[model samples]
Target: MIVTPPSAEEVTGHAASMYDRDTQDDGFVFAHTQVMAINPEAHEAFESLVKAIVASIGIGVYEAATLGAARAIGSAHCLLAHGRKALRAGVLDDDGLRAFAHHDDSGFSESEQAVVRFAERLSADAASMTDADSQALRDVGFTDRQIVDITLAAAARNFFSRALLALDVPVDVVPGVSPKTAAALTARVR
Candidate 1:
């Protein structure tokens, strides 16, 4: 476990923090304590970014992309963390979230499919991204500005969440998905 668990009060992702209670609040706790402890301002900034991202996409699409990216990378910590919260927040259905974990192609809408594809591209091979993928995003109606923001966010999650897991931080964010996907999602390894 954690060599030194950060202060509970400093932790933002607690079980009772309006996200997941029993499931993945530990990450929130770690995130809270780490960033808030260092600079409380970061807390507000992160919150704002989260809100902006959610607002950028309708809930379904955001959750689909987030869950899809998390699962595609098999990041157990991030997967369970975001998956639970996304589902509870009505970002996605349990089935779709779980399907993402299994790398299933079905369950996502055409637009969502495109979004997830973007996330995957950024996650799997950031530097080697092909021009076609960016074009595909444009063809799908994503503006160039939005594409940049999306890429930054996806990369941030991948790097940040992976760091958290590597550091032995407790995960608190549950996968935002339907209960059905929980089984399939949980079955996959990091």
Candidate 2:
């Protein structure tokens, strides 16, 4: 990482709390969390927004959108992290995640495919997005609120992914993700 993260002993207040939460949840502090915790307020706010979006839209849908945006942005970090989340949420199996990383939408439902396409377009070229982009979501039976949450999920991934890339943060070796799946997820990153 270009920036040095605070040592565990140096972390205090909200940052310390974040470290504790990560340890409790994931059994370790994620490098991303450690780096982002450098600005605890911003990190907390961003995490809260992500939690809200996930709560509003189901984890399955959020992971689909996030994976799409991550692929579009060529973020190996997001792809691996969200791929593990998708697996844990029962949204995708190992084969399904591999297919997604390879840009094959065959394993996904029509609604999920639509969400992925929409997120890919938004992340890759938001400037060219039109009303039709949102219309696609409606066609797939997404309500306005669900659509908004999906947008938030994708946009938020872009923000966090870009920050990691900008800072040259090393991608975490996400536990529970298979090596084959990890290679597929990172294929585009190189």
Candidate 3:
């Protein structure tokens, strides 16, 4: 995937508008968004799919699942972006962010740990998963609908993260997280 990402000005239609909005909201467009800008329609459709999934399971869980999947898939870009989003959503503190990679022993609840495994396994091998895999989420109080939504969120993260990595997209610099912290997360993926 040695594709060149389009500049914001190079993008047309809905994607150009989306890039503008991302810039306005975050002060800069993310590399992943810039790459998707080449096909604004597909980018919009993907955003819609992720929006639906996030709305169903809530942002916190969605971000948590994204972190797990991103880590497993070795997408440094996502690990940083979603890790920041998780922090912004009040799901984790600075110290918690530092421990996110080792989520199982990071003092997360059983439910949270389950979400991480679900996301990682789904990213690694979805076909190998059985009903019991989803049942564990239910045992932790996730509804069938929530489980489905979680699966979709993880799948969606994998889709975007893998593409960005394959394209050799660099991670955008997010504030608050030091370069050292970001480098550590990126190193884990390598």
lDDT per model vs. reference: 0.61, 0.90, 0.81
Candidate 3 C-alpha lDDT tens digits along 110-182 = 7877998999999999899999999999999999889999998899988888878777877777765767667
**What's the true lDDT of residue 103 in model 2?**
88
- Summarize candidate 1's per-residue lDDT along 46-163 as a digit string, tens digits: 6567677766665666665666567656666667666776667765566766666767646667776787888877877778888887787788888776666566567666765566
Those runs of model 2 whose alpha carbons end farther than 4 Å from true positions after fitting are 25-27
Candidate order by decreasing lDDT = 2, 3, 1
lDDT of 2 by residue, 1-190 (tens): 7798998899998999989987887798888888988999998899899889988678888988999999999998899988998898889999999988888976678999999999999899999999899999999899999999999999999999999989888887888899999998997793
In candidate 2, which residue pairs get closer than 3 Å at backbone N, Cα or C atoms, i.e. clash?
none
**Superposition error at 67 for model 2 (Å):** 0.7
- Candidate 1, position 118, lDDT: 85
Number of the candidate with higher lDDT, 2 or 3: 2
The reply for model 1, stretches above 4 Å from the true place, is: 9-43, 89-91, 171-180
The candidate that wins on lDDT is 2
